[model samples]
Target: MQPVEGSDKAEILKNAAAHVAKAASSGSKIIVLPEYFNSPFGSQYLPEYAETLLPSPPKQDEAPTFYALSTIAAENKVYLIGGSIPEFNPQTKKHYNTSLIFDPEGNLLAAYRKAHLFDVDIPGRVTYYESEYLDSGNKLGLVDLPDYGKIAVAICYDIRFPELATIATRKGAFALIYPSAFPIATGSIHWRLLAQARALDNQLYVVLCGPARDTRGTLVAWGHSLVVDPMAQVVVEAEEKETIVEWELDPNEIEGTRKSIPVSAQRRFDIYPDVSAGTIQFEDPKLEEP
Candidate 1:
């Protein structure tokens, strides 16, 4: 769930803690929160809300969102993906839209900053220039779970890049989890399509969590949190509301789909002469090979 905007850190943590307790009591082994769950969605206000990692001065008092995530993982004995947080990089004096993974024992497994910034001009309505306030990550982030195998983390706008998901799949991720707060305009056309495409292309489970509907009406999010199986089928989906969508996933499905399609084996990397060079092109024939 998206933590209410403009709420105090303490209040957000309390709500998250309670949610964790409820999920644990009902037997959920893993939970994913929406992107920027701790604060509202705006670049201008990020500096006031940004935080540093543990062992920093701000961490002495304990970051409410981080503390909540650790507590939730420990208390539930479940894996938790603390979606994307506005993390401060003191050296650069810039914030990173970051995602952190916690194991059942509250161990920090991996942290990933959003590599791709949202920079677009949407004509008349809304424009997001994420680079104005955030630094982009350079590498892929992955974590392993005992029962679920390896999982990869990607933030909101990252879903549009297929290469990110391809790299994760190549690195042995059985599933891809994206915590996003996609705008209603884009979400209506691209959210489910991207999710299904990634699953079908990589033959891995794709799980997405997003902010619930906003009655405040400033920017409505298309809230359809869902789990797509290896066959690119929606196993289950949550309504356009604040809720959880749960499903039983079989790790073996990845292997099964891979075995059936064998796309990995069929890749003709050697046949492509451009592999030796540093450039590859995607332009269609302009003159039709006449």
Candidate 2:
């Protein structure tokens, strides 16, 4: 893993490509990078970092992270999840916290914008208000692969919501990947627990990739990146330092677990009164039309 420093787009892309090349040489078929591996954090510089949608080439002065990711995927003949990047939306003229996936052939397979923005006031001590900078995504993201089966993606804060994972599972995702930059305070308390709980509850593999420690000291993130199996067993975990973790996932286990528990088929939605409750309430009819 490359511990990216500063927001120099070219340098970060070069480092990431080198890491992916090294891993590919070592026989890794799939690689996942940490969240915002392409850009710097904080809401201040988001406008400058956002990338346009696919088929529309990124600006010449833009960082090479996205292009490098696609090239690496094609060159290494490996599946690459381009972690989370700041993406520009043509319609809204705003940026989004987004994740994109590429196939071995360099085809854009899937993309996801963070649905749950990280907006919280940490008891008057520290606060992270992501909603102020990012626009939330409305749809869940899933991609299908012949070898890995169906894989779902969720960004950092999305892990806190089980409904997102549930929706992914309902979409036939056998594995879930989370690219996060969880702060030290919350990560220390809930990171591993949330990953384990999501895996066990969904009976699917969960892979988490987190950024290395930040020296800024203000929003330092915990770096316990890990991969958990369907039974909530840890396959590989990274220490506090920069690291790369690789593991072979078995799809047969997903089939077996679902057959054994059959929880998906046994869901008692009929008995749940609030299952159909409207979550989005609008104050006016104009607000309801989009």
Model 1 misplaced stretches (Cα beyond 4 Å): 1-6, 54-58, 273-290
- Encode model 2's per-residue lDDT on 1-290: one tens digit a residue: 52544577778787888888888999988788888877776677678777765434455445356667889999999999888888766677777787878889877677777889998887844588887768888766677876767788889899989877876776678888999888787888888999999998899999989877776745777887899998888878887777677787888887888898888788787886432244532111010111
TM-score of each model, paired residue for residue: 0.87, 0.87
RMSD of each: 8.3, 5.1
> Please, what is the whole-model Cα lDDT of each candidate in the order they appear?
0.75, 0.77
For model 2, name the residue pairs that clash: none
Supply candidate 2's per-residue lDDT for 130.
82
lDDT of 2 at 267: 78
